[model samples]
Target: MISWDKDFKIYNFKSKYGPWALVAGASEGLGAAYAEALAKRGLDLILIARRQEKLDELSKKLINEYSIAIKCLALDLSDIAHVIEVLSQIDLPIGLLIYNAAYAPIGDFDTIPSDDLAKVVDVNIKAPLLLAKFVSKKMIENKRGGIVLMSSLAGSQGSPKLVTYAASKAFNAILAEGLWSELKEHGVDVIASIAGAIVTPGYQQAQNAKKAPGTLTPDQVAEKTLKALGKKPTIIPGFTNKLARFFMGRLIPRKWAISIMKQNTESLS
Candidate 1:
């Protein structure tokens, strides 16, 4: 396990949230952490995940602990058409919408099939963008709300073994920035977060198999993300990851920068 110092600017929310917050991928990982943090801020929740049982269990804990309203939506985001269908069913005035679900497969292009590529694009790129489009309209009509998209550090540069994953994140990063520019004037905030490696179940399993790095914890990432929502359109969630972005931004040559990324990915296995 790798341990590093974390920097946090924990701001207290002075006013309680009105209506509800919808969190996709709320059954586990950083998404679950965000759900808990928002609940603590007095926002009622609408939790979405593929696992109904897990969503129900988490909803119970949030309601029992925070005494806030909790709603659960079990969704498989892979079905693009059904996402819109699912959201139309919710009647609550959603004050916050967070699209946090994602999937990734690690390997070279030849080894990773076209079907896998489409799946990643569907979840990491298409789903979040569609969700943003739908929710932005709702927030627009309401005239006040916040929407956050979960992006990743892989987005900042090319990821060789995870080529499509990096491209999908880049799409999200740009989409969030563009939306933030457009929506802020309308009294709605659109924020995208680039999360670093975190101590979630997926990361833990990757660690056990010597695959992914053990970086920041989910709570640690969540704390930074919450602080960044209103102030900036885009945020990188850990100290090292922030520094990485800063240096990556300064790279003069795109070819050289992507070359470094390719080397890093080759070293992973």
Candidate 2:
């Protein structure tokens, strides 16, 4: 585990962002990593995911380790209404919102089932967008809070085999960019972590090949992204991913970049 860098970011997290945080998709992998990082920083957490057992286990572990209050809920993020209903019932004033859940269907766009694509839209696009809408107003009222939307480096441009997933991620980054500007003046921090590959359990299940270059651990990405929260609209965690974004976004033709992505994501197909 990468230890927190006090020298790098010294925000009085509890004071500036309130006492409580809510992490959607908090059952495992990157989502669980985000929950851990925040828990270590002394924030009480409201953990949400689809698995009740996993949420219960995680809540027990975190409460044991950090001695912080926790509330765990099992619900599908795709059902935005149920999620909102649950959120409303929580008496705690959640000051930090982390939307880490995403549905990524990896294959040629046309070959993939329409229902899978629709699931992607509901989970990846609708959930985060609406959660941000619901949470940000309270942040604006409190005059300080944060929102972190997980995106991907693949979302920077059109990735062939990952078309639907990439497109959905692109929606998140753009949403965060717009909200960062609109919400910053209200003292609410917003950032999109346009991350590269991470060695999470979900990633391992999906990937058939060896670890990709510059693959980071979930903790590393979580730590770096949280550190960068109030500082930028978006962060690509790894240096390799940052370099990739620079070349793809600034140093090449659009067609050339897309072609590069085709080769890069061919394995995913």
Q: Which numbered prediction scores highest in TM-score against the true structure? A: 2
Tell me the deviation in Å of residue 13 in model 1.
5.5
User: Tens digits of per-residue lDDT for model 2 on 160-227?
Assistant: 98898999999999999999999999999999999989988778877664688889999999999998
Instruction: Please give the clash total of every predicted structure, in order.
Output: 0, 0
Deviating ranges (above 4 Å) for candidate 1: 1-17, 207-214, 267-269
Segments of candidate 2 deviating more than 4 angstroms? 1-11
The lDDT values for all models are 0.78, 0.90
Residue 50 in candidate 1, Cα distance off native in Å: 0.9
- TM-scores for every candidate against the unseen true structure: 0.87, 0.94
Global CA lDDT computed for model 1:
0.78
